[model samples]
Target: MNPFLIPRRPWTRQCMLPLGARPGLGTAAGNWQRLQEAAGGLPVPGPATLGNQPRLSGDAACCRVTPRLDRPKPLVFSAMWVWALLPILLVLWGTVGFWLVYAMAVANGSVNVTVVFPYISTCGSDPPQSCIFGQVMNVGSFLVVWISYLRFQQVRDWGCPCALNTAGLVLGLLCALGASVVANFQQNNQLETHLFGVFLAFVVGIVYFWVQAALTQQVKPRHGGGWLGPARFCLCATGTALLVAMCALHGLGLKSEAAICEWALTQSLFLLFGLFAEDFRHIESCCVRLQGRAPSPALELGAASTQTLAL
Candidate 1:
């Protein structure tokens, strides 16, 4: 007999056997055969049972495990969109507030070339209302322009393109400084001080052009039938014309009425131009780019097509 096939028997024949096998005993051969036959018909454990256990299948393994990462929240994009619009709102507020207060000053005879220096120098003596309004307008304009420049920088995600914008902004601040100097001059020759103010104003105009050129590159232009583009152009042009007229009238010793009227018109144009430039540029660019075809040959003036070059 093969040793592997032989069963180890430590007990008597009364011991239980597995389902498929029968225990041997001293028995009649016919009875033993009958028992063996009965056991052979029962189910037997296969090779899967010897110290082996069931395992997860491939699909079951994948489903049972948790992912290492979680899904991100959806509000991030909406928050960024709101952050982008903040600069525009600030600029509009500053422009509008400055214009309203300036117009009031002009109407009340509180604003004039002759009084420009004295008004600035002796501002503390006047009601705090006038001084505060002037300071707020000046500071607000500076803050708005700075914010606008920063916004443009973020939108482009690029290095600074030109020094012209920086120069323009700095020149504007210098113009204000110049006005202060003219006011504090020991000799109270109103004419000389007024002339200096006019000179400073002209410098401010040059600064505007530089700033506009830089901004144009950063912003888009308005589309067809939109009044914003034309309005901006008209405002800037009218302001320029008025400034020239004011200077000419002053030089030619023209009547005060003409100077006052020109000054008022210039201020109005400046306010409108500053307030709408960014919006106009954005709208115009969107329209042009959406045309489906290249812009017309006549309109293809390099960066001019997008108003980026003009500013």
Candidate 2:
């Protein structure tokens, strides 16, 4: 979620310290400015000690400290931000790019993406959508795998199961490798290898979703509801089932039906990723924040004692 939209505590008037009318001993010579401090200066007050400290003849001595009114920020490290956006961005980019290329390729009725399209890998052989298709697939698949690995660590951080996380991470990597292979070896170049890569990508992708769905359910109860849990499983199942049906139809010489099934299958897999995006978002390694813990009880007591030192 965007930090700004997370219902954070704005610098409220109630939370701010009142301006003081008296100067402290530390004020400039003869200035006696209300905002100035006395020469002796105010005693140093920690957040917790503010309420208990004796009021001194210094600026804003009666001002109270404010307590944080929001949940403590997570301790995300520098490298974690990479884990957040890469996978999501790559998949979206690839999907959009592929469609753009497909539209261009089919614009003049030069190629039919529905039936004659053996697979996405062979799209490179067509005009207007050549090598770019494979490049997008390769990049997207690589990021997907990396994201899965990062998700494994993220789930672990969320106190999820180790074995399942490991399995999901590994399968995700396998899926990426398969996709990369397909991109590297197009149907015309090496049909067997291309077919194998497609098979590997789909099969491993299904298992990856299965593990990810389980891990998502183990997230802290405070986070959110398990709204996507059943949907995640169903999406994975739908993709896998479509893949099977698409293959069977293709083998039985129903090329057009197979193409539609294949297209829907890919969409289903994409939807599967989207289902758990909310669940794993908090653990993203990218752009993570490091924040201080919640103020202690003493600090709460000092809420009415800490004052704003400046306007």
Candidate 3:
């Protein structure tokens, strides 16, 4: 027996008497007659009456059994603010790694100061700096994957096209994997594999941003899709131009200019990811539910009979 269903005390006929029915009748015959009249006056539990009664599955019944607040307050802070930190932290990590490597290389004279403008990889290729660069990129790659998945879920929850959203998620994950490759395989050691990572991070990364831009337009968030959609598109375009310019400059024997373009392109991609904060701001809460099937008619009837007997 459920403790919640138990009564505090046994019910008596006097306590249960209907309004206007005298409970103080002296004669047994008179008392029996009054009780019979009261019972006859009560409404019968017919099909129509049962249909009008609130079932255990009704909203009122559920509310009574399981209490819940209309608006649940957060314990510390909103998760959206935490989500916004991901891109910012990722950019900061990469920037710190790049500068740290460069400063170390300059101090050690590992890179030529005059002839070649050092690319990000050039700064990381040497000892000590390489270790820091690899660690930073590996961690940043995980952050990239995390941010990408969150953004994918955000769009998916907003009812975006499944195929397009799935493609975007795949592209973003691939870009992160590429970043990991670039980090592990130093250009000085494995030039070919490092270049492949560059293609995934830059080329595939640009495509992912473009897909996200499309999704931004499709969802049209409450805050305003008008600005974010166009903004994302512009960022994607700028990244694409930078990538092309970087490749073209390298091909044309302008290694210094190419290196500059590469750096600019990388920063632009980071900025693109940070733009997800605009969408994330609108998210207040997230929910997960575990449901069980309703009781069968026979079970329901049995329960009802048991409850009646208990009463």
Candidate 4:
């Protein structure tokens, strides 16, 4: 009999092979069994079959794993956080200092004429009213500065080198305090105090300007014209003119109350203008950087172009 027809040792009990079985059918069967064992004893589906299929340990079904995509990190600057707190501290100092001056003025009298100088008569003989006016002006000035600094800080995204800027701001605050002290002493008819107060005010004004210029340099350019440049020029000119007028009036021995008052008002206006200019410059610079365009030179030159027209 032929080997193909003859039963082997393990297949002796079996009478016949299944359909589609070949001469090497036993070897193929052994291979299929091994493949099933590798797949965790699960039945291997034929390529022609289609339906819900169970997952196998060594099957390609688990090969559908997806990889995660990485996102870019945000850029963070160290300087921005440092400068953020400086303005808050400055505002607090200004509030406390102004309040103290007001309290002191009230304690001395209803008004404080000693602080008003030759312009004392402008507010009448009441010293309390003059003191109150001075206090109001002081508070207003502080508010303007605080607001401007905050605007600048926001636009720059850079922190003030706390050590340098804070020192300058503190010095300016001290000078303002000194001025108040002198004014109070002078009101009490203390000539020495009056002179000291005037000196302190002058010093503070100078230091304040210096600090402003230094801080302004750090502001990166933005969109729009340089509004601050012209404004700063105007302020410097006005301030110089007022300083000259004050000195000239004093030199001529003219006790003109109006002249003194004008000098004080002009000085205050100059300071306000300077502060506004610095803030505008910072904002404009920030805008320019974000938009990636240079500010128009013609627009910058023409002051009228910078003005926001009201409807």
Candidate 5:
């Protein structure tokens, strides 16, 4: 059982060979002495002989020196994701929840989605619909609109032209606040008030994005100037076309055509935010300002010369 012990079962009888008065007895004794010496030379391995060493086998000697470690798989909602990404995701989820309630209402014949021109609040006009709509609006926009306002602040801090930046920031705040008003006041009960909120949010919201887009072009930050460059112009153009189409359809007394255009335009406005996805790095906090202008090429040359002269 022990690694150190030598096998003796096969050799037991041989080991006990008797020395007696017989022919060639002395020669046999010498042979037995030589056999005992060879047995003593056989290797006996033990733990104490080698400190925690793995026992060698066969003709090859190999060693494994290090221990292997197992690491856990990464999670979806890590700390950075929760803090920087969650607010944006929750805002989207909440907005989608509003549409989900609207769909349910349409399914039940409580409201018509396509031709009726129902305001978003109309989804929650009745008892059960109100529960889903209210939670999504109150809880979801609660994070989203404020986050929009903060993101607008980052636009300003990018060192955009003063007047333009202030205008954008104010419009963004109005958009956020107006959405809250629309959420709180049901269109069925307070139609005028809800309409007023819609005007503030929808109209001002576009202006805010326009301003943000202008800022995007003027003062570039490290994270700001990627695919967003082309996306800004495209979204603006698409939104403008949708707005014009909505107006023309409404003028022609096609209510459904106009309403669908209005809904698509709203989605286009949200898509503008997608263009600024770079701003997400600073979403939970304010915009960061770099200390000074990057040294001009001329200044860089001068500094290089100075260093050379010193050397």
Candidate 6:
């Protein structure tokens, strides 16, 4: 196939030249000359030209070729609102998974609906529901990691790069790791490891939320914080109080109250993450471009070089 004349899709990096017009060499200057000839001696803009209006000249007047070296716009497929779905999906996955496991345990007589007030881990400690619970938590942890990084980027972009931002990211990751540990190591089988994971996910997780709330207040969004800032602070306060109360209740051998507190705390965390929808609404597109030296002479002169970008 000819290097310069082949038709291409709209999003391609390579520039397409007119059909039947062949250049001497696969160089920018050479292509510019061929394009001029194809336009019947028309003085077409050169590769270095900037902001030149398109001109229609002799024979091929219909085809206006602008050979300027302007930065190419990246192809954007989705709207900014697409990012909001991440938090929603995370919340749905968690809520449904927790309830599903509880229901399954109740049906199988593994847990008593009326007599025993069970923790989320207790509901998933048995057979069939345990498998589903593990899968749900593993997937949720992966989503949490992605959300954490995005939140970190959002804060940095807003010009608030303090220690709190970094701490929030680190704590978010730790909470995710804890969730994964709790998923794989059932409380019934590995009590000590499971307890450690619970501590990481619940204790560290609440602290992470508090850190995020503080950051939200520090770096208000373009449209102002509105309800998001206050809502985050509320969730943070509620989750923290619930966490402390749960610990005290558990230490006092009040298993039922502690279990209720655990459930409430989990929901509060989910709600807190869901509020990130407002934070992500402002992002339209994300692009990654390679930074490398100019193409080698051989690569430029008909040696094929391809690069793929994943979004």
The most accurate candidate by TM-score is 6
lDDT of 4 by residue, 72-97 (tens): 34444344333334444444544454
RMSD of every candidate to native, in Å, equals 23.0, 12.6, 10.6, 22.3, 20.6, 9.9
When 5 and 6 are scored with TM-score, the better candidate is: 6
Give the whole-model CA lDDT for all candidates, comma-separated. 0.43, 0.63, 0.74, 0.45, 0.60, 0.78
Tell me the lDDT of model 4 at 92: 50
Ranking by TM-score: 6, 3, 2, 5, 4, 1
Best by lDDT: 6
User: Taking the tens digit of each residue's C-alpha lDDT, what string does model 3 give over 260-287?
Assistant: 9998998899889778777767766555
Predicted candidate 1 versus true structure: per-residue lDDT over 27-134, tens digit per residue: 223333443443344322322232232332221110111123343333322233343354455446545654555556555665565634222223222343345444
Instruction: Give the runs in model 3 whose Cα sits over 4 Å from its true position.
Output: 1-78, 222-225, 286-311
> What tens digits encode model 5's per-residue C-alpha lDDT throughout 219-269?
766464566756777787788788788878979988777777887886787
**Preferred candidate (lDDT higher): 4 or 6:** 6
RMSD of 6: 9.9
Which runs of model 5 end up more than 4 angstroms from their true locations? Answer: 1-87, 113-121, 222-224, 282-311
Which of 2 and 5 is the better model by lDDT?
2
Residue 274, candidate 3: Cα error in Å is 1.3
The number of clashing residue pairs in model 3 is 0
State the lDDT at 149 in candidate 6.
Answer: 88
User: Candidate 2 on 186-273: residue-level lDDT in tens?
Assistant: 7777889988988878887887887777776776762436566777777877887898898899899987788778778777777776
Q: Estimate each model's TM-score.
A: 0.41, 0.61, 0.67, 0.41, 0.58, 0.71
Clashes of 6: 0
**Residue 83, candidate 4: alpha-carbon lDDT:** 37
lDDT of 6 by residue, 194-277 (tens): 999999999999889889888987885443357888888989999999999999999999888999999999999999989888
Clashing pairs in 4: 79-159, 110-128, 111-127, 111-128, 112-127, 221-285, 222-285, 222-288, 223-287, 223-288
